[model samples]
Target: MSAIASSTRVLVIGGGPAGATASTLLARNGFDVTLIEKEIFPRYHIGETLLVSVQPIINLLGAREKADAMQFQKKAGVLWQWGGEEWTFDWTKLNCDFTSSFHVKRERFDEMLLRHAQSQGVKVHEGVSISEIHFKGDRPVSADWHEEGSGEAGRIEFDYLIDTSGRAGIMANKYLKSRRFLKAFQNVAVWAYWKGGKRPETGFEGPLTLVSVPDGWIWYIPIEEDVHSVGLVCHSEAFKESKTKESVEELYQRNLAASPLIADLLKPADKVSAMYVERDYSYSSDRLAGPGYFLSGDAGCFIDPLLSSGVHLAMHSGTMAAACLASVMRGEVSEERATRFYHKCYRAHFVRWAVMVSTFYDVNNKKETAFWRAQTLSKEDLQGAEWTDLKPAFSTLMSGLIDMRDAQDSDLLSQTKSRLDTVLQQIRDNHPAPNDRFYRNGEEKFDWGRRPENAIDGLYCTYEPKLGLVDTGPTERAFAAVESSPAAE
Candidate 1:
């Protein structure tokens, strides 16, 4: 072996949740890993929510105790506002089996993950950016990078490269095609942390609520004790005619004024930092792995943050990528096989999420104006075609074929049929009408009927009959196409 090959190690780019998780997992598996990140420790990031699946991974890395002790808030599920009414449901109602999840401050949560990685023998360096990459043989031979604060240049060769750089340095950018949404969400988020806001008790029965408006929605995520991650996601059309170039703070206040709930919450709270805005909520990248390198988290793809799924998907993908790469490094599998594993894992994860995003805009009722109408009903608004291929890939994951991505693939017709039957059965078992109350609130209030079921369930079927079912055939075909496609292992 060449001297360069002897010195070669695993190089991980980006130090966020995905990079840190992947690096730590690899190191624990006994690989020599080096994680280089562009930002310094404890930087601010938008996604402060975590899913129940996160706990096991944290426990695996021996950071669960530390994470539990950190200043954070636990969430039961998400509460949504629709049709001028509010409803709350448990996230545990979904397929995953966790009683609750947590909201965390990124500063402490990220530091905890990185420290765990470092303690596991992973070498970590911050404030470094990759300038170029050289691929020789079947793997990356070297990468040239510079330290951020000092601007010092250096290079390193690695046996394998893992890119978890989130959206900044898309490792798959060269292979990325322009993925347009059928109906663009065209919403921007203005977010900042505050010391005082509503926080649900740890292991409570309610979700952090989202107050939905005609033009957009507001998310209230509670982080460490007494600190809430608050933000507004509003439609782009609303800002088109506005002539003022207001500061972020002004815009936030204006948005708050537009909503009574937000106005009430912000009335006494003080902003801790300058308000920041992020537009373009949706995008997709199909080819997430090439040759010896693999992509995870936002580096692979991202969907709308409406579900607060960013951090959950990132951490999950990082774990799967690390496992697949480690399999190859251990001679347990061929590199070609590993590549296939990576593609399957990444696709299975993102495709269902993409479809759910599509479904959100498709709703016609409770929607006011052309923006909301166009987003849901029109097929022309669909932006990215590469994601269409994801439909089948998503189905496979839902069928229990893959666990990397949490997607379900049943067709609307099949789901409705299943739900109808399930609802009837549940009614029989419970001795109550499947649902009790049906009403719509708007400029005028309309009452449809009465029952015990939640209002949202009256229009949409509950969990047993709604969106989360796994299909068998279409899913396999999707997986086969992805596996047989040039993009696969």
Candidate 2:
């Protein structure tokens, strides 16, 4: 073997949840893993609300105890505001392992994950940026990078390269040249942090609140130390046309004021940070792996933030990438086969998420404006397509369920599913008739239309965090063409 290939060295770019997770899992599996991050730790990031789906992933990483120690606000469930009414549901309804997930401060949460990776024997260096990844033949040989503030340059070789680069898509943009943005959720966000913001009733950390308006929706997430992270989401049209001559900050404040509930919550708080702008909320990379490299999380694709799926996707993708790469390193899986698996699972989750995002917008009944109008995925909106199963069916995926079941957790998952189904049936028996205003098909109308997309009669929830391998519900429900039917696994 060449000197570079002699060591099972892995270098992960970006220290976000995905990168930290991938490196940690890789190192735990006995691979020599290193992580490169551009920024120092404890940096600010959005996506503070976590779904119940991340419980096992955290437990798998041995951070369940660590997370429990951190004392983040406990989220009993989600509290959503739609059509002038509010309802709350607990994770017990889904048989989640934890009584509650967390409402985290991303800066602290990410740092914890990175530090946990460091604890697992993964080499980590921050304040260093990768200038370029040099390739030999089709495989990456080395990466050229330097310290953030210094001119001193350095180069390092690796046996495999993993990109958990988040939305930057360092490898996807620099090497593969394959990223396509989805117009359906093509949107931007205006947000800021506020100290002394309102909290949910004292017993729980969340009921992470989502309030939808005519232009778009607003998120009210309680983070650390009695602070709340608030944001507004809008498509490009609403961002530009709705704002007109207003600056981004004004737009943010204006939109915040426009919503009565959010306005009431923020009225007593003080803005702790400048209003921020984030554009292009949705996109997908065409490929996940090439030659000696792999992509995970936002490196591969980004879905809308409505579901708070960003962190889960990142960490899940990273862990999955680590597993796939580890399989090849152990000679347990061929790279050809592994790459195919990565691509399939990565894209599957992305497509499923995209469909979910579309349905979030589809639930808007108040306005027929361009902004809200574009969120629906009707046959005309899909351009002559037929998708049967976009309707929400269960709450399992809200926590970011993967399609595949892990062998180790098979028994536990079975028990969880059985209990979850029991609760689901109880709800089904009491579920009121479908609301006529939103009922297009024979589908049962849910609050926010949030349910399982392809809920198995009792078995269809996605299990693993990495592979989007969802059960197709019997064999007949799988979709083949996306432009036509996007409702399959």
Query: Which lDDT values do the candidates have, in the order given?
Result: 0.59, 0.66
Q: What TM-score does each of the candidates earn?
A: 0.73, 0.76
lDDT of 1: 0.59
Q: List the residue pairs that clash in candidate 2.
A: 53-399, 392-451, 393-451, 393-452, 394-451, 394-452, 402-463, 403-469, 403-470, 456-460
How does candidate 1 fare on TM-score?
0.73
Candidate 2 weakest ten by summed lDDT? 434-443
Best of the candidates, lDDT: 2
Candidate 2 per-residue C-alpha lDDT over 1-489 given as tens digits, one digit per residue, 9 for 90 to 100: 011222338989899988988888778767898788889998988778886656667866778888888888777666667545554554544433455678998898889899999899888878878889888888887888787676656788888999887777888888888877665776888888899877655344467888887668888887776788888888788788866788888777777888888888887899988878888557777788867788888888888898788877786677667767866777755677667656655665665566556654555644776668766433322221112222333333334332112111344334434443443343334444312111123223222112233332212322233222232333443422211333332
Tens-digit per-residue lDDT, 266-329, candidate 1: 6667778677778745655656676788888888777778656677778767776776676677
What are the root-mean-square deviations of the candidates from the true structure over C-alphas? 12.1, 10.4
